[model samples]
Target: MITNETKENYNQCQNVNCSTTFVSHETVARYIIKPQLINVLIPNG
Candidate 1:
């Protein structure tokens, strides 16, 4: 299950004996340095 307020995903174990629950936080990474154009040089054959 995902929550909109905290933007986190909740995961629970199906096993009734364990019943372990885990929460994952979701986040977006902002690009500090954008992709730069690459130049490729081919050798004459």
Candidate 2:
């Protein structure tokens, strides 16, 4: 259920375990958006 609007929320993963913070549209798009789109891609996964 990821959307361009929902993408605005939780802008940071804050991977404290890894001591990293992904904070950018492109970064989020790659790590988050692509995965969701994969499942929703009409052809199916």
- Please provide TM-scores, in order, for all candidate models, with all chains considered together: 0.36, 0.17
Candidate 2, residues 1-45: lDDT per residue as tens digits?
A: 255534333355557776555544322334443444345457756
What value does the lDDT take at residue 39 in candidate 2? Answer: 50
Those runs of model 1 whose alpha carbons end farther than 4 Å from true positions after fitting are 1-7, 26-45
Q: Which pairs, if any, clash in model 2?
A: none
Model 2 backbone overlap count:
0
The best candidate by lDDT is 1
Q: After superposition, how far is residue 17 of candidate 1 from its true place, in Å?
A: 0.8
Question: What's the residue-level lDDT of 20 in candidate 2?
Answer: 53
State the TM-score for model 1: 0.36
Give the CA lDDT, 0 to 100, for residue 5 in model 1. Answer: 31
Model 2 whole-model lDDT (C-alpha atoms): 0.45
